[model samples]
Target: MKHHCNRHWTASVLICAALAACGGSAEEERAFVASGGPDTPGASPAVAGAPVYRALSTAPLAEVSLAPSDVDFPNPERGFYRFATDPARITATSLDYVVADGQRLVYTPADLSAYRTRDLPSSYLTKLNTGFAHLRKQGLKAVVRFAYNYPSSEADYLNAQDATLSRVKRHIAQLQPVLQANADVIALVQGGFIGAWGEWHTSSNKLTSPANKIAVRDALLQAVPASRQIHLRYPRDLATWYPVPPTVAQLLAPSPTAAARIGQHNDCFLASPDDVGTYWSASPAESAALRTYAQQASAVTGTGGETCAPPVAAQARMACEDILREGAAYHMTYLNRDYYAGFFAQWQAGGCMAEVSRKLGYRMQLQAVAHSAVAAPGGLLAWRVSLSNEGWARPMNARGLALYLARSDNTTVALPLPGTDLRQLGPRESLQWSGEVPLPATLPPGSYRVFLGAPDASQALSTMPAYALRFANADTAITGVQWDAQSGRLALGTTLQVP
Candidate 1:
């Protein structure tokens, strides 16, 4: 059985700690709802040089050229330690204020546009540089929706589809050179409006005939180079096949029982109660009814009983999800969460993110999750550290965590601190360590070297567009550094274990 990922909200980390680690909103206000979307009345779309309700896909990126900030981490451990991750690409978010752990100030539609069009304060850029530098030292990549026409309703984008298309073409022309120029700012764009909140699909956008859907997807797939990545909204259903094996007739009749062609299915199997149970597991009656429905639907389409029964619309949102998931996957495109209308229309600052965190029983950060997938922090054997590397390219430049620990001998091991780094982290290569030190035993542990470097070498910096300056992974230093006390190493948590 497919198990649903545990849906819980992670509690917010203390802001007191984040205050120093995190930077202020790029401007007096955030430009757009970085997430959430659907419908809006009176919203106009982008026109040539026209200021739309939100910024377009083509916005200048905040140049991460500033000094690194030093995080004053606590050494003695007692309470649960905490630190905040920096915003990777704070282009012009429009996330309605989401009061997270302490307080999360997102952007408004107007503010998002302003951030893009207005000037960047020297101070803000300085602080941002501090964060990016720290993350770079650790070698990680940052993923953020720094550029987009997000938080705006799909209705407007779609209504303005002709305009939006032209706008994208223009944006693409500009982007090609900029992307070509920068090796650090990996920009992401979706082909057009997608998902419940623009995630990918679930509503009217999901209504396309398979053939049409494929056509639209193919065009998007062809737009960018094999090198640069384009982000897609999730519940992606561009190219998914059924789970059922080939028809029993084929299995029984042929020595060469090749798997049925993609999207090709046999409705004859639905005729048998046992076969139906084996396939979809519905009751005999449900099976028979599905078989009959498939036969009729197939006859209407002339595709030989388009057996959508097994891929029931009620349970199988496959036909729709494929547009995002498989389409992007096949093209090696990155997939962002399905930002949908349901989310945007109903989003309340503290309520929505908190609800999602609580539903999952934990807080979630898109960039952080991806980074943590590789290396997570170890609890204070008990020490906290703040590391900042201000270079460009690092570890695929993912953002998650960066920390360090000393061995009884005097060697220092780096750690990818939790919540401290995300997308912007790779650029910062910085980390602020926090938490009370605790050790299971007083005995001397082996000298260790820990630090957030890059994701494994399987990934290459050049593979993706050079968005930022990639950095070399941290070097192992201070082997056998002495520790102060006894300790039990606890697994770092992206999410806390809950009841």
Candidate 2:
């Protein structure tokens, strides 16, 4: 496969001669000449002598270790303690407080209980928009859910808590504009608006039927932008839409269909063998199938939730060993850190809290990098990166990867790595991306610092430092590579000279 370079200017004849001297093929020289050369107007003519071609290969001088970070940094989509807030209650100060506590994800449930019998008020819709604006300003994303009620008592559970199917659809239509407008700040939308707490069960309106569930799921998929996914409360609900589990190839495919966009959220995670009816199957074989599907599907789509208090018999499964094992198996991205206080305390006392915190999402660390030591303007600069994802899951949201060339003056130019997708880098998976990118013909000869950045795919947040992915590697005497928080780039600790 031929990898096309994204340079605007053409390679000069001198660089072609240098390439030939460095053992490049005749066809490669012709391709570069055709791309841009003296034949073009205002193009610089090739010099008589060939430029120096210096190839350089370097690995970390010190041993690269996978040490967990003790400091909390802002990594967009994945993390612990999804701070919950009502749309009306969200304020910049409140969000700042959460950010100060190292939380990047917020959970906001748009309460529609009062409007169940009618359409959502204009004021309520404004509150929703305002809340999203706050999240954007605070450099945060939200796990949004629109639910009718929160049943706190047995009597409340027995009452008609949610609107009818027709009303639910209308409400979704009303919220569509807000959802699409603020999709950039939305992490994922929970499949809510059905039962109490929107867990897709025990609906007083009896909206839990298979047909009804499918309707709500489809509506939600349409209401939310295709870039964002919808998370159901149970794995069985997803199996209803996709009985056949996705193969490894499909899960790793570049583009996903709407069906693949539906994921799961287990509110009562690890509460029981079935996770409090999350996998509601009496038959052992059927239960096994559901569990397997959840594991495989969540690998691509994403999954996470809070821990419920387990019974005495189920407490064994809540230990550190089980937690880590199952966390990797299901590919959890985020978990509610506040609800299960006892379990959190237990993990701390048992000496696994730090590791759990470190591995909650995508903790990518640089292993090595190789590139050309020197190159002429408009010449091919071969580059390669070796990295590993140490976290339990890859980034579920869309992300763009680029190699940045920055000058000492802080002037920077980004060369997009078109085909590199961070979502494909799974948990515990190592990926090496290598390609040749041509330096701009107008680029001045200088020593440039090379850095790598994985920014949010959306243009609106792409340049924001808080939305950029951070590497797990720390800056120390041993490991030269370090994450630059101010610039939102990972310094490769290597330099490229353009002569």
Candidate 3:
């Protein structure tokens, strides 16, 4: 699912790309798929099989009995690396799965909880505002690649019979106003890496075509102030991405070459029973499953393609191996062969969510600050926050705004009362507020998840995410906060507990 990168792909290259989709569709899904994939010959049949993907609680969350330690990164290195993950394995996880390319994300309760529960080390979040934050500091603006996660495919994009241009036009029409509003944060549109969450495929639902790619990219380019430029980077794979410094004709070409792509982009974490690829020339079962998932994705996105049966582990490898060989000039990476390191390490029967977090770099994060000496016991914790509305629009209608506060006991508490919530802040109009919470007289002696938004509170376009507070030595709590330049302020908000 590599979005409309315009990367060059021979029919054979596209055929073999089945394995490379991140999340292969995580990112062919820009953030998931390394670069992207292409349609393949149909699969043999459907194999009915499944994995224990932690099913979501149908009813409301009845308060999970989480470990006292949550949200704080167990490792300091993870945060530093996730933003700039290795390109090799990054594409292996479905091309750009870890972090989709054109997708814009606001923290959700699930994400916040996962971080807290896993005790994500300082690595994934900000130990200090460096790297990406530094990029912001350097005046390099960022634009969210707001692509919908549907299973459309290139087939639809290129559907000459269908009035797809109208649909695309409507999408651009809808986005134009929003883009104009958040003009500050938005430098240019990278178009969507849409389809199957932007996986560059034409089967199942996520589909796009050379013509459609031109339309989307043109839309993005047209929206920006010509002074700024756009490039579809992020979850890119050398073999699959559109080469940089493209020719004007190449840029205009519906089918461009991605074979010359270079550099680090994305290919997030892949721990799955779910693998996207068509193991053609193999068994019916393997072919069937890939077909089904593609269809499932297709049904959602309106792209059309084939379906097959479920694949076995070897089949998964077979499907992936088709495109990940040196001789083939197709390269890919997986967690490992057999996946003992990926699944067995976490879900080895009764490993629990924490175990999954462990392999996920969750456990790599340090535990809650159990024994830090609060330097100034009497100093009230205060923070400075800046909300830079540099995005394409005033996204937050202020539906839900609250700082999710957790303690060392993994106990969740919401901390929003009357008179909280930011209204519409135009482009550069950001909001900065300071709130206070008293530290418990006796620290419960655990970690903390101090958040800004409420459960599933993703609507708010808050630039910074609610983060875990590390009581390094009492008097000090560290969080992965963001500094908003447009607002000319530092975004900070977190509660404290002294254990």
lDDT per residue for candidate 3 within 104-127, as digits (tens), equals 211110012122113334442332
* Model 1 stretches with alpha carbons more than 4 Å out: 1-161, 164-170, 177-189, 193-237, 240-499
Better of 2 and 3 by lDDT: 2
Specify the highest-lDDT model's number.
Answer: 2
Per-residue lDDT value at 176 in model 1: 40
Higher-scoring candidate on TM-score, 2 or 3? 2
TM-score of each: 0.27, 0.85, 0.27
Q: Which wins on lDDT, candidate 1 or candidate 2?
A: 2
lDDT order of candidates, best first?
2, 3, 1
Cα lDDT tens digits for candidate 2, 242-348: 88765435544565676578788888777688776778787989999999999988888778888877655544367788778888888888889877777787788
Best-matching candidate per TM-score: 2
Record all residue pairs in model 2 with backbone atoms less than 3 Å apart, i.e. clashing. none
lDDT of 3: 0.28
